[model samples]
Target chain A: MEYTYTRSVGPVIDRFFSGLADRKIQGIKGSDGKVIVPPTEYDPYTGETLSEFVDVADAGTVTTWAWVTDPRPGQPLQKPFAWALVQLDGADTAMLHAVDAGDESRMSTGMRVKVHWCDEPVADLAAIEYFEPEAS
Target chain B: MRDIAVVATAQSPAIRKEERRNEVEILMPVVHDLRKRAGLKQEDIGFTVSGSCDYLQGQAFAFVTALDAIGPWPPIDESHVEMDGAWALYEAWTRLQYGDIDTALVYSFGKSSPGDIRRILSLQLDPYYLVPLWPDTVAMAALQARALLESDGVTEKDLAEVVSRSRKNAKDNPNAQLSGDVDVDTLLKEPMYLSPLRKHDCPPITDGAAAVILAADDRARELTDRPAWIRGIDHRIEPHSLGVRNLADSPSTRTAGEKAGVGNGNVDVAELHAPFSHQEIILKRALGLGDNVNVNPSGGALASNGVMVAGLQRIIEAADRIMAGQADRAVAHATSGPALQQNLVAVLEGEK
Candidate 1:
């Protein structure tokens, strides 16, 4: 059995998805100068509308991560991977994404990772595919 | 605020699966037991409210079917919340404030064995971003656990101790699903199911139901010899996006605890609904509970967590201790949403 539902992403969210489709990530500046990726309309803490958008580097440092030994259906990867909270360069906040590190031993806090974009542009979260260890 | 008290409570023993019994069947005996304890009939209940998720049962209006347990034939003032029973009790408490009603029946049930609970819970996330990733419950919890470990300087051994203590405390709980003496050293030796979290650190998926009979003032005293009077109650929620907030701390919990007056007096006992061991540590800090306070003496969610009823069970645990003359003041906490995104705190006290 299957079911389907549809919704409008609205202006604030639409801006973020549209940017993702073009392979460019944008972070909006909050009242306190913190940059929020996958931008929100208002600051969660200050409750002020944010308008300034800054383009952040695709590569970032992993603030925290959890290794998943077994993959469940619909996850970004089929094999073992690490789900990380990555603080993209120039952004104060972090975004949640999968890290394609091969082994648990390879993943660590403060490790540098860069976004691996999908082969084709898709205006959704999957467009980012997953993050890979940054090349030295 | 009208003086509200938990006069009576009953809960089914937590089990992995009740293969033969349906939701109504699981709830009937619990409802009957509480009513009998309170010595009241269906008509005597001024209002009825319950909490349960339709997604778990895989059908819409699934809660309506459970009404059969209440025998709604003669018609009754009833309502339901698509959340944990703790929220349902909150609604009932609010209803009693109008002075039109003196008594209310609150209950909740969950049967998660029928479906893949992780997949079902995934639907609760924001559809566009978080839901598309389909991160399961444990994985989300793992994310928080890692953050807590990194920022708080807590070690894996600390998490193991919490697991060991929870199992040991659960031995006294007849309704608990997992209870016994577990060695902390052995737990640390076990492989990580989700890195930084051993299997013992997680709660057992359970099927169960619980009921509480609430009364105000004189009605409360008439129902039971000792009533667990609600001294203070408040709840709060953080942002829905996990990325937007700090995972290491529960600010919402801290706020609710302060507003609920958790620090107003000595807390003899506290029943915190921390399903994850690491979460228990975060909650203790959020509520500012000292070492003297007994936390999760009934083993808490780690021992037996009913999907929709565990939060209510925490309240019942605290109330039971109060009504039994074991404690004068206690704090009961309930959490909903992924990674403790929302929290409810209530202060229960016994009559002097």
Candidate 2:
């Protein structure tokens, strides 16, 4: 069933999504001085409120990947694509997003990737259309 | 804490669809069978609780009708959880500890045929980041499988062997939806539906229900010749963010197993709720079960995963073995959320 209510992205995620709209990536710094990508409101380890926003590079490495032969409706790509958890540059944790590598043969762990932004940007995850393998 | 034991258990055969009946009809017979087995009526049950998901049917409060199956004429004490039945049983066990309840009935059911369960499962993820990406459950599981493959010396053959053993063991389970001999070599040759995971490596879409009863002290003795006494029970959960935790291991399961006293005795049987092949490996290591421990003798979730019902069925399988005099001590495990994020471990035993 469809929910008809609007969800508040809250302050922490609002900044992250706002960064997506500006073609920038934002992360929150944990107590250990580690950057958590696609930022969380509180420290993942300490549960302490975090406000120090860190800008991370859009380029990253694929820590793990799964090739989807058949695309489900509402997925990032209509064609066959791979789901990769990319540890964005400067971020300690991986961010799950679709990778448009054209074929399963091209995807692998530890491969370099960069965000592919949409033509028109919004404060949503859809702002970054998907990730694509970085050129050698 | 007072002694509590599993007195009766009943589960419907795992199937693709029960077209003729809805959730209530699907649950009635199993509840009927379970109550009869315990020789208890509705009023005799001190507390009544059930487990189910409204998202399965895309409707809210869908479990109220299933409660009617129990004939709650006198308005018996009741409750519900939007989680697996194992959690419902855990609640009942806690209530019995208050010394107010002598008996409690727990049941769970699910019908995955009506909706796209893969997409539906995404709702369980973090909506802001994970849900918007729309990574279906299979694709997410495939990520874990790949991490497992690259972590240790575990080969693709190890995964296939898990599927093969599950199918073979299910042959003897009357309630199993899938059962047969699976050739590991032939299975390895099959195309990967989601890379690092073949269709055979995943659980089938199953529609089923299960019921179980718990009694304390001398009341448990009146219900059955042998009550599977609950020695210890515990559950734990890690963070929901998949990116933050190591997918290759389940530390939550490890802690829960330890708290439940799994290592305290020689485990005669272990019924683990591992819907995916590689998860069995993770759980086995976390629980420290040896090769001598019988794992998933009833085929497990690979043979029949009924969402809300599967976890409770694991408890039933382990308890059934103890009640039947086939096993002396058993460890039962249940998991919820994506990639073993939430884990419940229980230890059951019979009088030696």
- Candidate 2 lDDT over A1-136, as tens digits, reads 9899987979999989888899999998988888999799898767899999999999999999999879998899999999989999999999899999999989999999999999997988989889999999
* Model 2: residue A61 alpha-carbon error in angstroms: 0.6
Candidate 2 residue-wise lDDT, B69-176, digit = tens:
677787889999999999999999999999988999999999988889999999999988988878888998899899889999888999999999999999999999
TM-score of each: 0.97, 0.98
Q: Which sections of candidate 1 miss by over 4 Å? A: A1-6, A46-49
i-RMSD values for every candidate model: 1.1, 0.9
lDDT of 1 at B227: 98
Clashes of each: 0, 0
Q: Write the per-residue lDDT of candidate 1 for residues A47-111, one digit (tens) a residue.
A: 89888888888899998899999999999999999998888998888888899999999999999
lDDT of 1 by residue, B45-110 (tens): 999999999999899999999887687868999999999999999999999988998999999999
Model 2 spans > 4 angstroms off: A1-6
Report clash pairs, candidate 1.
Answer: none
